[model samples]
Target: MAKIIEAFVDERGHLHTSPASAIVADIAAILGRVGDEGGLTSGVAALILEKRDAIEKAFADYDMLKSSGATIIDVSDRLRFQSHAE
Candidate 1:
């Protein structure tokens, strides 16, 4: 779960906080419920493991763009263009 967080310090030396999205919160809540009952189901664990690389890549991309000073609008525009192009 900590891996989902991608906090960083900016050039000004101020730390930026990464808040979990609603989707993440929902997933965590569901997982917590299942954990309380017992523990992670094999399927759930396998799914999380399968998605780990993609999740890590997303965090890496976000951190890279943030460190490069790219705004959300910039990423949105690029993604929009790529979607249209495809």
Candidate 2:
């Protein structure tokens, strides 16, 4: 059975998982609404667009994480510890 993963927003405002399609759609909608507001740095916009794929992948990996009962903190810690260990 396919598992349903819950999305979480941490204290830092970064998404715990890749934004779901619906979330991404909402963001795009909001960006469109504020498109003419100006003042956004090009680098920030480009960074967001660049991360689109990673965000999508995170959403796709959500099921895997849910099935394994892994938390973002767990993954983050493991990666950091492993990097230091090496």
Candidate 3:
């Protein structure tokens, strides 16, 4: 059987390898090429396109919470407190 992998981002804005390491590698290569051409913004745009499904799913989860009466302020405050604690 083939192993499944996952992809995640670490603190350094680079990808951490997992099952989705191939996808991450592709994004990194594109980013590197764009960066070499002094196009960081375009590189990020490319990355967003590559990870659109994951990003959309995350946003959908957030939207569900909002529909449940959670405010953006509430989420922001919690994140701020967690950041400080970290």
Candidate 4:
């Protein structure tokens, strides 16, 4: 009669050891390479490129609103803001 040999295992029942930090580092490296290779161009990117000027204008408008301490209005027709008080 042969004796059965049993190996101690953890809850996962796997011998592979992997840390979370290693996985994150690998993902970061892959993303860095992808970014260097011109990034992932999707429909959203195309739309942004098409309306880049409008986006820049929108950001500038928001910054102006913050600096001038103006009141913002979001109407169905358009966005209107009052100038800062003197």
Candidate 5:
């Protein structure tokens, strides 16, 4: 079966003190219940695998942008545009 690999977050969020293994165990339990409810575990796995590359790439791009010192301006623009669009 496919596995969820690493997780990445931007440097600003509050750090959770939970162990990584605990998080993985929680996800496994959730997926097990989802399967019991007629959700296809294999389908979920396949979809995640398919999109994994794009997801990782997007995160990496965001990290690069933050490292370049542009996140504040980027976030401001995003909020302004979203507010106007709404």
Candidate 6:
């Protein structure tokens, strides 16, 4: 988790990574390069492409929310309940 945090931000607390949209575009590029090899059959590749399309929509929604200056709301389970679930 610490490594992930460090990857996006430097010691001075500045962004050291590309925008989320750029990362999502990279994901799309990788999906486009998928081939029927390494157990990735044509059918599996089709499914990946379909899923990537849906994921792009989600990313666009987040981008809109951020651009609108809206606060991003997320849900977190209570620690007591989380411990029990674990």
lDDT of 6: 0.55
Query: What is the per-residue lDDT of model 5 for residues 1-86, given as tens digits with 9 covering 90 to 100?
Result: 99865553323332334444334344434566446664565456445555778978989998998899873555658878788789
State every prediction's TM-score relative to the real structure: 0.34, 0.28, 0.40, 0.35, 0.36, 0.33
- All candidates' lDDT scores? 0.58, 0.59, 0.65, 0.51, 0.57, 0.55
Tens digit per residue, CA lDDT, model 1, 1-86: 34575665433444456322333333444555455464554346446655979988999999998899865666658878788788
Local lDDT at 28 for model 5: 39
Clashing pairs in 6: none
In terms of TM-score, the best-performing candidate is: 3
Residue-level lDDT of model 3, residues 17-72, one tens digit each, is 65244454555555665555655744575567678899999999998998999656
Tell me the tens digit of each residue's lDDT in model 6 across 1-86. Answer: 34545345423344545444334444444555445453444345445555877878989999999999985645564565668878
Instruction: Write candidate 2's Cα lDDT for 1-86 as tens digits.
Output: 99998776533455546545335444544555433564443334445666979877988898788889775566658878788789
| Least accurate 10 contiguous residues by lDDT in model 2 | 34-43
Please tell me which predicted candidate would have the highest lDDT against the true structure.
3
Tally clashes: model 1.
Answer: 0
lDDT of 4 by residue, 1-86 (tens): 98865434333443223443333333334444434353543333445555769999999999999889775666742422333332
Clashes of 5: 0
Alpha-carbon error at 25 in model 1, in Å? 16
Clashes of 6: 0
